[model samples]
Target: MRPVYAISGGVSKFAKSRPDKNYQALVKEAYDYAIKDLEISFPAFTEIVDGSVASYFSDHFSRQLMAAIMAQDYLGLCPKPSHRVEGGGATGGLCFQEAWKSIASGHMEVAAAYGFETMSHVETWKGNEFIALASDVSFDYPVGGFYSGYYAMMVTRHMKEYGTTVEDMAHVSVKNHINAFHNPYAQKRNRYTIQDVRDAPMVAWPLTRLDICVMSDGAAATILASEEGIEKLEKAGAKIPRPLVKVTGIGRGTDAMRMADRPHVDFETFIKDYATDQEKESQETMKYYQKLWDQGTRYPGVHSFRAGRTAGNMAYRHAGIHDPLDELDFVELHDAYTSSEIQTYEDLGLCRYGEGGPFAASGKAFLPGIDYGLKLPDKPVCPVNPSGGLIACGHPVGATGLMQAVFAIWQLQGSIEKHFNDDTLQVKDAQKGAIHSHAGTGTYVTVSILEKE
Candidate 1:
């Protein structure tokens, strides 16, 4: 895969809102940023793929629905085979996959993939509904099941079963926010404490506003080229960028949309055995509280766990990584919520089941030199989500996955260190990194591994 496709250049910038720029302008901004540092021509790209969701939310958004074609004209990359790829929040990852396939199959020499989303134009409720549309409409949507609520249920169960305290979850938010302070593109850069996270307004029980990712408007783009394409450009007297990172492995998977369809241990037994002090209340009070507990204990989406595990397994197999905690240098996973990040640690094989909370709370997940109380891992088990992930950097749905890829490419290229001088924020001499994205209520999951060439 390294010899087949290389990420030559990439760009990503995000904000809470971009009232001045629409979807096209955002895409153009990222495209320009990506190409500005490279000596590449528009004609050199044989294919173009656009990854966007909710384009209608942009101020001057297109009604044509042909986002890829519209983007080609906007960027002046005319006559090339251009198309749009979408897999809910993993839209950008799918675009990258398509670009890789095009070049790997010998159908194209060089391809460009870009993703954007303009979500701030609409009201918050409307935006929430739009995101909820990605879930199973027949089952999940009708029951008022949004992402936060689904994740809240998962975290609640994790806490009840594994003794994961609220403080453990708050630590995840704290660590990511600390990392975000170093990222210029992050939506929220303010440092926070466990008390602040605990005091924030609750969006869903056990999940506060600060615990979830903010909706944002942003864009990202990446240019991928084959070895033959690089040689062709060089032979034609074109200057090519040196030290491009290669795509070493990629894996994708999907799971059932209905949460109940997934295989999971019956958490009811755990709840019964580990009943909290609430059980000591009066009989009437206990009955009412038990009713509430019963309502909240339903398995939300075990598919999320299964999907991530499946994808990670395939990626590890392809990359020949038997022990992710030992082999990988860093990770940029889908931290849509802090709980998701904790769960991902277990799912991605970074730690054992029921141990993700302790692993994260222990400060092992934080980069080196950051004093967060607990001692860092004896050997750092891949600093997770150093980009602040979707939690603080914002989740623009369509653009999130590509942003992860861009971060990995920069990290592997050793270019991230140039932007931040902090040793904790830098992953020096990083030869391998992995990026993961999950979308559509766990209906789609993608894991991509990159290596420095």
Candidate 2:
């Protein structure tokens, strides 16, 4: 276990291209924003964590060894202990976990974590190759080289075992896109329809182009300080809130990294341990889905069900979330694909397993009407991705986790603008939000519950 620390940080807008500058420029932009906006000084960094998806892209985009050193040299904070680590796709969120741990363990007073990626320089196929290399080369290379196909394998298994629908996945996409529309920094503001998704050509059978998160080129950075540092700041007349975004928990686990090599038959089985029922449609939908499973083709594969939920569960338990959907105010999810978000909501205890679609259909998320006195309905519906998730925000690979962290901080700080302008207040006393992110096909899932207090 690691002691918790405060996140006093900022990040850059996730985008498809930083045409005006190179990789270092992009890094500098993120760093400068984090420093200036959050009032952090470069010399305050006692440790650093550098995160990127692939070495090939790191070379092409950043053109530097040890991203921490690159950051330190650029900011002239060298000689402070720094290194780099990569956990397949879990790189960015895990890097934040690492920095938080260092500060919590009394190893460092102040730490800096950065995630940068420029996938535009490289062809799409090459990026796929980089992801493939993360798997067992011998097992994965023999099969077809499609990245989406690998996740599609899980989707097929999920559909077969639980009767999850392509429509359900499409619903996730539509919801995320709608949420992203309000996000000024999101790369894709285009709204999508379920019919549009159904009509679009399938990238993988049962999965369409709309189901996938687009390749993005962006960077994000954060500055973390230990309790001592926080106390020092307060003593120096700098105001800092208590219990501010602490890293209450952290965990790491891995299953079959490759899709084909997985032995699991049912996707939901991955999360059976923490499964719960949705009061609304649990029995009927589960039975209907099972009926579909009995009729459909079964292609059992390794899904992120356990890994993703495990990460969230750890964070939730540590953060003392007795009831997530009600206790949590909002979420910035890892919408790498449409299904990822819906399934993640369930995994995070926001809704019952297999009832995410119906829950989403209820239109409880981000309700249309607003009244300051109008309390949330009987069933609490936490807002998802008010910041536009990876699907719309542009999946800048490693920067996503940091992007989410910054968004969480912003929401907690009351800096976020409501999606719709209402004459009157909507939810009473709204202040906190959650941040959820995953790396590489759900190999790593991180959930942080942030509060204003």
TM-score of each: 0.85, 0.81
lDDT per residue for candidate 1 within 1-453, as digits (tens), equals 335545544545688789787777888887776665455554443233222122112222233466656666787766556777778777777777777777766777767777787777777887888778777899889999788888888788778755677777888898888888888878988788888899999889888888988988888877777887767656654564457688877888787777767654345542342222223234754464355445553332451376777788777777777777778899998888888888888778787556678887776677776655444445455788888888889988777888888888778877776534444577878888999988755668888888876
Candidate achieving the largest lDDT: 1
In terms of TM-score, the best-performing candidate is: 1
lDDT of every model, 2 decimals: 0.71, 0.62
The pairs that clash in candidate 2 are 89-439, 89-440, 90-439
Task: Show pairs that collide, candidate 1.
Answer: none
lDDT of 2 by residue, 137-190 (tens): 677666665568767876676655556788777766776676666666678877
Error in Å for residue 376 of model 2: 15
